[model samples]
Target: MTRVRVGCVHLLIAVSTVWVTQAQMGFVFPPVRIQAFSPRGIRVSVPDVEGITALLFDGNINKRIMYDKGDIHGFVTTKTNDYWVLDDPTVELHSGDVINYNVLLETGRFENSPILNGHFKSQQRHVVFNLERRSPPDSSLTVAESKNIKCNQSVTVVFNNNTPICSGQIIFEEDFGTLKEDVWQIEQYIPTEDPAYPFVSYQRSAVSVANMALHIAAKLQQTEPGFTSSSLYTFTLDLTDGCTGKMCKKQPSGADILPPVISGRITSKNFAFKYGTVIVRAKMPKGDWLYPEILLQPLIRNYGDTNYASGIINIASARGNEYLVANSKDYGRHVLYAGPIMDLKCREQLLQNKILVNKSWADNFHEYSLRWTPQYLTFSVDKEDWIHIEPGARGLVSRFPDNCTDLPRERLASSSELAPFDDLFHISLGLAVGGSTEFKDDLTTKADWPKPWRNSARKAMLNFWKDIDAWYPTWKQPELLIDYIKVIAL
Candidate 1:
């Protein structure tokens, strides 16, 4: 009985081994055969076609392998002929454009329908589709409009994306290839989430070619996948003499009209109406003392030569100036803090009634919105309600008393009238330096000097040397860096 049981077990093991061998050597899935250009008539209207290589992979394969070569390459585009390859068998046709295979195996004849065994390309694998081809999207885009303008003209460009393209930035060049254009003033941004205009303007302020190039270059790239090549983004550009609506014909002596809008660079500038409230959304640099300003030029000539340059008002509490509301002379003014609870109605005769800086003036990108209707002036940073100045409310006064005339609370309130703010002019952005001529001594405290004022004084000294030396660096090179500047007209 023992011999009989042992013999039965041995027989079962032999049968199992035979079955496994047969499975491995038997039915094998065939390599997919791509029927050349369907005779039944399927047409692909690819404009440029040259070295196009087509690839396919199995859904279950550890990695999608290409037959052309054995490396990962982005999707294929052709300048002349479309390239094709037979990869996996039984591919799932998606939109007749992409194919995903479920089974991949060597070709062989079986009793009936070919099947893939448990065998795979490798024993252990990370299932990422690996491609092999030439390079990616060539650094060239179709030009929808190219005209030399003598006067400012509203230029419109409509792009047709037929294939998936890498998210790229725009650049402006002159003479078609002499690095960047001489003078191209423009602004642009992706109209993806918020409705804001991305403004790109040439910096007459920059002295270095490298620094100016950095400011002029707009770099953008796609970090997401699966975006089809046919998604088109449009741009509407208007060109005018810088600061003036008047247009010039042919690239002006100092200003040129035909500037390249390359990928990853700021687009040309677009101005809003003078009375229109300006919303500046910026990506702020670091530090607690940096009060970023969005410099803007007035649509109309500023109130003539009155040291009062026209711009929206910005409230800064830390850099020596605290914009506060006057409740009483006996009582100290209210100090505005971070968050939405802090709101002050400020209307400074010396400053415009607008939120001049974004909420992100110190840290991350923040949205700074200023509402300037005929009746009320509201300022918000990062969507947090900060302050509002009503038409009949007390105007913004200097934080510190200076040579400027001072007014008593009750008497001044009755006599003060809100100045009619009409146009916006050159948009300037800089930090408030303590010793700079722009600073008002009225807000400085001899007591606060040892702490906050001391810090400002130090920063001011450093800034002075930096600005002077920046023009002609001896050892260290200066860089022109601006993450982004946006303006909205509503």
Candidate 2:
């Protein structure tokens, strides 16, 4: 739990901010700003600080003071232990100026803090305080004179109909301590035998928020009142109340049956961003045919031909299979994949680089970062840039000339090389089970004890349910665990 506070002492102009994680003590955050002191001196009282004993600052080029153990060693006025006034005229701050400042908060426990500097010994200082600054805007212009004023110094980020913000500002953050419906909309529909994710039925019970994180677990379809995972018992699923898309009602046919597995998928309905850095810290799930996706989908798909025309950025993607030898290679948790998809035909061109890690990505939480800009898109794991894409002159379409032929030509409508992708995109997170298109039904993909389901067969779901004993035992804690998802302005 982090709580940051910014104090105001008569027109304190601060544009920069420093963040420090007090993993040890979690003391009340940080350097209490007390600038904007007049030459006559202003009494700045820092409240809410009970344990703080010493306060230090560079009074001027010739003077430095430290209030420690009730001993005032400065030229300023110290009425009480927590009360300080800058009576020194030489250290007065002006309206339009910049300065480097730090607040040493010695809580007695900062051995390896990121903000701690080497200048102070561990015994003397426990925390470091660095302040942010930028020249204040000119106040000479009146409301009549300021018309259509455009800010050029701030970073360009569009969201919530707000103006530009300072660089490195956290525009969006979800710690997943509690899953809020206002931020994420659950996908509740039975896409039985659909092209992309035709196997699983997304239900609310499969997902949960707990233990300071979002847990999206996959559950077996229980043979209940009206629905059954088996084909022998004919049943139907009528999800009319909370269905997200069409096909709310489905039943067992000659071959096509109800979804054998129940999983979860959530889309960010309230947030969308154009170009910025996205960081998703999550642990991949482990199970057969489990597809975990961290993606950025366009808010409005207005460029390409069909469904995936505008663009979709796959920040990070991986299968949950523990080990599966596909074409003499293991495309399991040990491998990591990242890339993009557009126009629905670029599966070969969809993936940029499939990285191989020392162990499984499902073993622990790893940071998946996407640095998106107008000119390029960079993907990184743990701050290590693994793959980056510099859009061609014809945009991403040029990368798939022969495959995605139906659309790419429409990219000429825009001047941006990253056309389609240049638009606003929303964050998406979820876990899908038993998809036909993602995992092929052939030896080339993975025989894995003769994959219970066949992609081409109409009774794919029914066939998979028949051999539940073979794969169901492998389903152990098969859920997507997300630490947090953060977005920073470029």
**Model 2, span 47-93: residue lDDT tens:** 22444444333322112222221111132223232343322223334
Off by over 4 Å in 1: 1-272, 286-291, 297-302, 309-312, 315-361, 393-418, 424-426, 430-489
What lDDT, from 0 to 1, does candidate 2 have?
Answer: 0.60
After superposing candidate 2 on the true structure, give the runs of residues whose Cα lies further than 4 Å from its correct spot.
Answer: 1-156, 192-195, 223-227, 231-233, 304-307, 354-358, 406-408, 412-415, 443-448
TM-score of each: 0.31, 0.67
lDDT of each: 0.27, 0.60
Pairs that collide in candidate 2 are none
Deviation in angstroms for 94 in model 2?
34
What are the RMSD figures for all models against the true structure?
Answer: 24.9, 13.7
What would the per-residue lDDT of candidate 1 be over residues 328-443, giving only the tens digit for each residue? Answer: 21100122222111011222333422234433233333555555444455667667667666543343332314344322333333433433243343333332222322233233
Judge candidate 1 at residue 96 and give its lDDT: 33
